[model samples]
Every structure is written in C-alpha cells, then in structure tokens.
Target: MAKKAYIGVDGVARKVKKGYIGIGKNVYGPELLSTAGMPFMALANKYYATHYHVDQDGGFATLELDTLVSSPADIIGKWWPDGSFGSDSVETMITSRIRTAVSYSGLIIHTEAYEITEQTVGIARKIRKAYVGVGGVARPCWSGGELVYYGTATALSVARQHLAATSVGNYALFGGGETTNNSNVIDAYDASLTRTNPTTLSAARTQPAGTAAGDYALFAGGYGSNYSSGVDAYDVSLTRTNPTALSAARTQLAGTAAGDYALFAGGYNSRGFSAVVDAYDASLTRTNPTVLSTARCDLAATSVGNYALFGGGQISSSSSSAVVDAYDTGLTRTTPTGLSTTRYQLAATTVEDYALFAGGNASGGYSTVVDAYDASLTRTTPTALSEARYRPAATTVEGYALFAGGFSSGGYSTVVDAYDASLTRTTPTALGEARDQLAGTTVGNFALFAGGYTGSFSNRVDVYMVS
Candidate 1:
C-alpha cells in the first residue's frame, strides 16, 4: 500500500494517502484532477511533492519520485514560500517569459505588495475611495490591468488644445526708425504702431535734449533746419502739436526730469558748449537757468530723486572731458557733486536709486566701460559693454536699462544691450535699422526712437515694445 504524505494550504496542514485531499469540501481525485490543466498540477507538485512519506507503523519510508522534494532548510530559504508555491527567485527567472506570454494573450495580473498589517487594508481603501470618484474603478488588490482615471474634463480639453496650437518665439519691442534733421517730423513704429503717429516734437531739429515732465514732455535745445536755438513742448496725454518753445536756443544739450521740472544742462550754443543748467516747469516755463561749473555737450544726463546728474562731454576746444557733475533740484546751482568716470556721448538711465552710464567715446576711441552714480552722486566701479560705442540711446524698462543705436567699433550698430540693476551686461539684439545719435524714450512699456542719422540723416521713427 502507498504511504501517506502531508500537504499544507492557508496554514492548515493535513496527511493524505493515495486518495486526493478535498479542498473547500470538494474532493480532487483522478477524474476531477484529469480535467485540471498541467499548470495546476505543476503548482501542486512544486509545493507538496514528497520524497519521504509516513508508513502505517509511524516510520518514514522512501519513495522513488520523478521530482525531488526540497528540504526544510531550502524551503525556509525561499521567499514567499508560505504565501505562494513559487519562490521569488524562481519568479524572477521566469518573469520576462511570463510577461511576454501574458502580453501576447492580452491578459494582465494586478499584484500589490505591502506590509501585512491590520492598518494596511484601511489605507488602501481610503486611497481607492479618493481616486474612484474621478471615473476610476477600484479593482481588488489582486486584480490589475493598467490603472485608469479621469482628470478634470474641462482642464484637459483646454490643455490639449493649447498643445496643438503653434509655438511662438521670444519677442521684444525694439526701436525702429527716427526722423531726419527735422525733429518736427517725429515718427516711430512697432507691431503696435500700425501707421499711427503717437507723438511729435515741438520743432524740427537734431541733437536736441528731451525728458519727461509731470504728465508733460519737454524737448529743448536742438539745431533746427537752420540750427536755431529752439525748445518746445507737447502735452503727453493729448498728443497735440507743438504747444510752446523753450526760453533759450541751444543744441547738443543734456536734460533730465527732476521733480516738477525738466532740468536742461550744458550744450553748444553760438558761444560754444556752455555750463548752463536750465530747469523747465510743467507749465513749459523756464526758471533758474544757471551756468554749470564745467561746460560740456553731447553728454548724458539722468535724475534720481532730488539730484540731476550731468556726465561727460566735449569742451569748447573739441577736447573730450571725463567730468561728471550733479545739481540738486531742491537747492539752487551753488552745490554740485562730481562723478569718477568722465565719459562723453554716453547713454544713461535711472534704475531704482542708481543712475547708470554705458558706452561712449573717451580719449581718441570708443569705450566699453560703464559707470554708475548713486542718488548721492557717488561713483561705482565701471563695467564694460560687449562693444564700444558712442552716442547710444538709453532707456529704462522693468528694472533693466537698455542701450541701443550708436556709432560702434563695428560701425553704426542697430544692436541693443540691457544693463541689469545688478550691473551685469548682456549680449544685445540687433535693431531693424542701423543708426547713430538717436533719441530713445520709454512711455509705459514702449521705448520710442526718434530722429537719428543713418550715416547721412533719416526721418524714420521706430518703437520697441518691452513685452
């Protein structure tokens, strides 16, 4: 007679003889087992195959078996031995093949691994509940295909549409064109300009100084068609024609808006570059026109709070001087501060509390060095521009000061460079046109260029929008 062997399921072990053991009260015998596939038979044989069996006398008997039974040591060494018939090591070896077969048959199995503790099931249930409301069906931990869930329908639709649309490149508003020797014909354009002339000068002239006043604009001291001493004004909000002229005739001057007045300083007159400092009120009235301690022209000027800075220019004998001077708008002309770097035909703009000056002709050649003066007119160490140029136009936008359109070492440049408040210099963007001695103004977010000479002279105006 055959000896009996022991088998275990769900932690319950029992001895069985030649007759099959009943699972769930259903007997699995030869007839019932024959209908079962080879896979089920293999699973049973792996876990329950026995080489040594118990005899009726309670002694162990050896049986000749096609497969060897694993020792208890070997069984204990296997991972997941009690949980499943195959060990993790064996499962790993057949994983690729099993995955391939299942994929080919379009079948998938969901398996989850977690700590076997009382709290685990509750955590899983909560996760399922949270995900299910969004069109996700919670499958049992043992069941798996691919996890599917629905997102916000409206948001998904919008995102999909946006992805399908065209991509756009980074763009900026740039100075376009300017007027000729005649300042009266001021015109500037960008994609937004669209054939409309936004602002015009009070008179036709070149090398005039311009600055923004309280809701008004002051254009002072430019050579007219006849090089006449002319100053003009326009109500910035109304866009009206020349409202009035300056009290004096001067050209090649520098001016900055300080407080309620646009202070005009040092420029060439019939008497040559004067050290004169003139202030124009919002009513277009000139007052307290005082002579600067040092006479200069083709220089740069900017206002920071109470002080107006005048920096670098040619003296009466065409000699360039590196003199920086500052005048207090609150006080009269007696007191002025001096800058460390004296540069001429440079571009300057106010960034926060600091006024920056960059690129101009110094000594006999163009310079790349940039300098700054604080509200107190104290100098900071100068930085270098990527290129050396003179007579460039500078304007401030979004904490950045832009310098563009000037006579550079590479010739007249359409290049635009921005000086960050941190005093870092960046590579420039080329303008649509190459010109020098242009005037740049920032209104709202737009930088408008008017009346620059392109070798000879041009009447085209360009606008760059900092978007």
Candidate 2:
C-alpha cells in the first residue's frame, strides 16, 4: 500500500505524490475549493469551509472570492469561516440583503502570525472558539486570547490626560490643559510614537483647541482662571511666541488649519455660545472675522485638504446638536449641513479623504454612532463605536482614525476605538486610566491622547503607534 497521511482539509489520508498531496472538494488546486474559484466547500451537514494555506514565506494565503447567493436572506444568520460577520461587517464589501449580486465577507479572516496557518476551516463543526492576534501583526508566537472584537489590555500613559494636541511634521504634540490649576505643559510624540516632555506653553488653560500651519503650531482659547482670548504659538523647534489675543475671549470652540492660517470658531465665553472666529497667521498675529452661522460650544473640528469642517455642538435651546459648518481656506462659510444624528460634545477627525464625527450626547443620551462625510459635506453610512461616549478626542495616525477616552452614560471611560477608511471600528488598547475631556492629534503614524478630568484632574498622556 502506498504510504498516506491524513489530509488536513477533509481529515482523510491521501497518498503523497512526490512532495505534494491531493485532497479537497473537486480535487482543485490547494488554493481553492473548486476549479472555478469557490473558496467554500460543503463538509458536514450545513457546514462549509474556506481553505487557508501557510505559504513558505510564513504568510497565510486564502481566497477572497465573490460567490453568489440566491437571496440575501439566505446568509442572514450564517457565520463566516473566521467567525466575524460575513455579510454584516461594516468593512465587508458584501452587504446585500437580496440582489443580483453576491458576498465576499467570509473570504479573509484576519492576517495571523500563529506560525501555523492551517489548510481547513472545517473547525466550524468541531470548535466554537479560535485565536486572533492583537497589536497589529503578531510576533513569532501566539499573543492573543479567544477571538474578540478588539484585543486590548492596559497600556502606559503620560502624567497628564486632558491636554490639547496638534501635529507638526512627524510628531504629535500635547500642550496646555488642567491638571492642578490648569497646566501649561507640553509633551511631544515622535515618529516612532514615543513621548517626551517638550517646552510648556506660556499660558495655562483647559479645553483649548489647536491647528497647525506649516512648521508653526498654534494653541488658542481655553479656560485659565476664567474664559480666555489667549493665543500661543510654537515653532517646530519648540520655541514659543505670544500672538495678539483673540478678538473675543472664549472656550470650548472648534478650530482648523489651512495653508498658513488657523481659524478658531464658535465657543462659549461669558457671553455664552459666541459665533466669533479667531484667525491667526504664521506670525502669530490674530484676525477676528467670519463667524459661524450658528453659535455653539463643545463642537468638534477637523481639516481635510483645503477645507475645515466643524460639526455637532451645544446650542442655547439645548446642548445636543447635529449642525455642521464647512469653511474654505479663504474663510468663506457654507450653509451648515445637519448631521444624521443630533449630538454635542462629540469628537471629529479625518483619515485620508474621509472626515468623521464620532460619539456625543444625543436625544437618547450618549451615542456610539459615527458619521462620515466627504469634502462636499455629504454624509455616508454611519458606523458605531464600541461604546457610546461624549468628549472623546479624535485624530488620525498612519491610516487609522481614532476616538479616545471620553464620558459615556456610565461616566468617564478609557475605551479607544480606531477606525479605518470604511468606518470599521476596532479597539487597539485602552488608556492607562479612564478619562474624558481629553484631546488628541496625529503626526505621521504616531497618536497622542492627553490631559483631561479623571474625577479630579489628570495630566496623563497616552501614545499609540498607528502604522
């Protein structure tokens, strides 16, 4: 009898031919279930599998086929080979409930570093759990538990938490927030995603907004002993400059940068919800002009390409709002586009071309829904965060957009949900401490979440590597 070994695909021994073995449905190439390219093949009753082969280069190879289904309802409750939603995952290319189309969600599970990518997913019949890697690529060994949404554990943090953030070149910088009696500290994160204490801001304040122009980074308008009109500027060398004060004193505003100009718009001062906009140049000089159509506070602001978008904040009638305003580099304002959901105290960021508004207080209380928009301000399908929250900090690092620690219905939270271009959400790692009212920024692939109120006040800063 010819020597044979158990084929991993069907659990039946097959005679080894030279260095290769032939086993699988239809006896197709090892990469497929069928010659026509169906990755799925029938196994036990109601059980199907997609093949995974460990390449000689140590990478896992699998099929990403578009297979047709008679109706969307057919795959409604069906589980994918990797156990993630085959049809329902937001990043899934297949979302047809029913159509002339097909689905491709089950083809790719996740890239793993198990050093042991198997040839069969027929474990659908024998197992209910599996291992998944965390922290980007897995190392040489298993470093994960049972498959879960976000592989997270406690990580390190800076001494401060509620600090403001802005990026210059490949570094994310945190500056000026409340700790004990509002601090003027500055912590800079490098391209490798490490944090170092840089020069502190001249003025101490909390809730200041930041935007950068070329090599110059500006921090403006936060609460000191009281609402402030102060504007402080920093160069790439970490040197400081005192610019002309903002036209009006304010706090809790939205800010953005374009060209060499940075604009701070809409905030609550003693006047309560002012529409004032403060524009600063590379020289650290101020220009008070062009107000937001709606005056509100606690809004989120981010710049995409040549435009800055301000979205969702508190109004006089109520704190929760969905109003979004877009501005050109020339400071011309377009009519605000209402967000799909009305919420205030949300956080916003842009990853590549897509701008996102995530987590805030809505009519039903805290929200997890994230709204994505284009340059024209049109909204796309929204995704949800792992947890509903308010006052989360938002930024983009490498290719990932992240919303960090914030206040939820349960109180201050440390959950950090990272988003991809498709609004796919994942938890990287939680903050060292649970906090809210924090600020975040990205430099290249480095991210920093810093300074916020955690019961008392904290100066802790948490950094993450996005690449």
Candidate 3:
C-alpha cells in the first residue's frame, strides 16, 4: 500500500505522499514519491523538504527545507538570499503585526527582514502584509512592520553660537563658536544621545566650517586671533589631530563632503572674499581644487549622490549672489542650476535623494523660499517655510531634513520645519529656546540642534529621535 498524507489545498484536504509538504505556492514531494503530484513534481526533485505544517485555511505555513541547510533560528545574521536587490545582514525579524520580537511571540506567522532604508518606515503602512516561506523569495522588510518615535533633550557642555557641526561614525560634534569669548569647546553627542565634551580645538575660533570624509570630521579655517587656516580632524574615537592646514585662512566658508573628500570652499579671507577651495581626502591629504565660479561668503553647501554643491552667498557688502557651484567625486567642478532667489545664510542639508537649501536673506529681506536639487542636479521649489528666516541650522535624520532656529523679522526663531523624503513639509516641535547661529548634526536616529544665541548663549540641545 502507498503511504499517503493529507495537505490542505485551496481549503480542501488532499491525499499526497507522506513526505510531501506545501508552503505558500510551492509544494514539495518526497524523493520516493517524486511522481505523486503533477503540479509539485518539478519542484520535488529540487527541494528535500522533510518537515512542514499548513493551517486549515492553507494561507499560513512553515517549512524546513534542505536548500537553506538550517532552521529560521539559525539563520539570524545571515545575508538574505536575493540576487536582484543584492543582500544585507538580517538585522531583525518579527512574526506579527505588533512589530516587536518580544510583543508578537504568540503569532505563528513570521516576517522576513531585508535592508531597506530605515526611514522608509513612515510609508510602510501602505504596503500589504506578507508572510515568509523558506526557500522562497520573501518581501523586503521595511521598519519590521511598524513605526514609533520619541524626542529627548540633552544640553551641550558649553553654551555657544556660530559653531560648525558634523557627524562621523557614532558622534555628532559641534566645534568652535562664540561663548563669552571665541570658544575652543567641542561638544559631542553619541549614538545613545549621551553628551560629552572632547578635547578643545587647537585654537579658540568662531565660524569654522565642519564636514566629514571617511572616518574623520574636519573643522577648518575660521576667525580666531585672526583669519585662521588650522584644520582639526577627529576620528571615531573622538581623538583629535591637526591635519595639513587649508590653502588659505578664511571665515564663513561653506564645507561639505562628497565621495571620499571633505571640501571647504569660498569665504572672506584676510585679502578679501575669496573663491579658493581646499579638499581633503580620507587620509586628511589636502589638495587644491578649481575655485568657485563666484567668490562669496556664507554660501550653503551639501552633497547629494556623487556631487557636492555650494550655493547662494553674499557677493559683496551690498548684494547677494545666486550662483551654485558643484563638484563631483573626481574634483571636477561644474555649475548647477542656481537658487530661485539670490540669497546668503541659507541652511542646506541632504535627505534621501534631495539636497535642500532653505530660507535666507535674499537681497535685503528675509526669504521663505526652499529650493531642492535631486541627484541629477535638477532643481525644484518645495513649499516655503512657515517663517521667513536666515542662517537656520540644518541636519537630517531618518528621511527628514530639518531646518531649525534662524534669525527673522520677529527676532531669533524657535521654529523647526521638517521636510520628508517626498518633499512634504511638516512642523516638528520647536527648539527648546529661540536661537539663531546654532549648529545642527545627527548621530544614530537622533537629530541634534545645539548651541546658538537666544538673547544669550544657549547650551540647550533639542534632540528629535526616530525609531
């Protein structure tokens, strides 16, 4: 007599080989019973699935198959097997809609993990719910099926303004600003949102430009005792070192990183407003790149994809300039489409595929304009800020680019405007204090707004967190 077992097919129990199993749309048959089912015969030769279970509805199933060579519990930390999307180490897995491993333990249905950008979690609710079957392609995990976030406040060790900020590895550093006097203070916030004060800068200075390349955050060229050309580099351990100095000493220069290079460009030097550019590679080796098309100070800089852009600055004491200079990974320079309004003191940051320049003094008046440039350098105008302001500090966390605390007709603003990856604008909680000339940076899931003037120097650090 032929051994037979029952499997639910389309909600009906059907007789099949004893070793046969079904998972989602894939059915498997035992080696000896390879000819048993017409629909499953082709796959039976390929998969040696000895163990499986299906619910009466047949919509949910679990299977132990030979191809994976192990059980789900053993598969943790393994790269998901999919060629088209490449792969990522499985960071986590969840079994239910509740979305947490601890909360959803009772649900038998399991979800598979993939490495999609974590910020995509906000849009995850629009995706259809799915289940995983071993040896079959699984849906990519976005935020492990749900989203939640909270905010925390941390204070900078020192109250300061006009500082430079950048994140490298696990640390967000705010360096060189105005305190009671020029500040050498370098305040750091780690991934856990804990604050620390690292070694002070080599010189007390204000308006230094900060950017990161490779593992180091470099703060360069600001006014100290005089227009200074010093460049300080900090590695992952928060160890600081003086790198080769900038080609020229300057203040209010625009700094941004692209590819392996940290670039400091266009500022007022001792000579006059200068168009010089200094580039530092991963090893802190300095190189002089072709200068900006227009020499100006207070230009905002940010990188999207392969290009770093420096845009909108004060051309002279009387006029602002709208010219935008772009540099690719190779250090080749080009001019992208200019800003919609000629403005300087605008804030710039990158989120997802867009680099945004927002709100600055245009000609003489505070401007609310927000110009966005996609990876191709194509420019578009997003919604204007709710408030007209200039010199707002900007940074990105998750998919949100936040422009916070700037000077306006009303005085310094506490306003924090956030633009999501889709360019939609939302107002998050305002800063803990009304401030301008602050420094903004991010570490882990937190966006930190720290150090600015609010009638007085502010050490207040408002952190926005996304989980």
How do the predictions measure up, each by TM-score?
Answer: 0.57, 0.65, 0.72
lDDT of 3 by residue, 378-413 (tens): 999999998999989999886678999899999999
Give each model's whole-structure lDDT. Answer: 0.52, 0.65, 0.76
List runs of model 1 lying over 4 Å from the truth.
Answer: 1-183, 188-195, 198-202, 225-227, 239-247, 334-339, 456-467
Residues 315-344, candidate 1: write the lDDT tens digits: 856467677766675635543444445568
Root-mean-square deviation (CA) per prediction = 26.1, 16.8, 13.2
Lowest summed-lDDT stretch of 10 residues in model 3?
115-124
Ranking by TM-score: 3, 2, 1
Query: What's the best-to-worst order under lDDT?
Result: 3, 2, 1
Model 2 misplacement above 4 A: 1-161, 192-196
Using TM-score as the measure, the top candidate is: 3
lDDT string for model 2 (1-467, tens) is 11122223224333211121123333222322222111233333222232332222222354533322323233334424444445543223232221212243222222211111233222212211123365773322211111122222122234454467787766677777765467777777666656676667777888788888767788888898888888777788777787888888888887887557788888898878988888776776677666887889888888776778888888975556778887777878785557888888898898655788888988888988888877666778556899999888888765568898899878889898887654567788788778898777766535666667788676565667621
Best by lDDT: 3
Give lDDT for model 2: 0.65
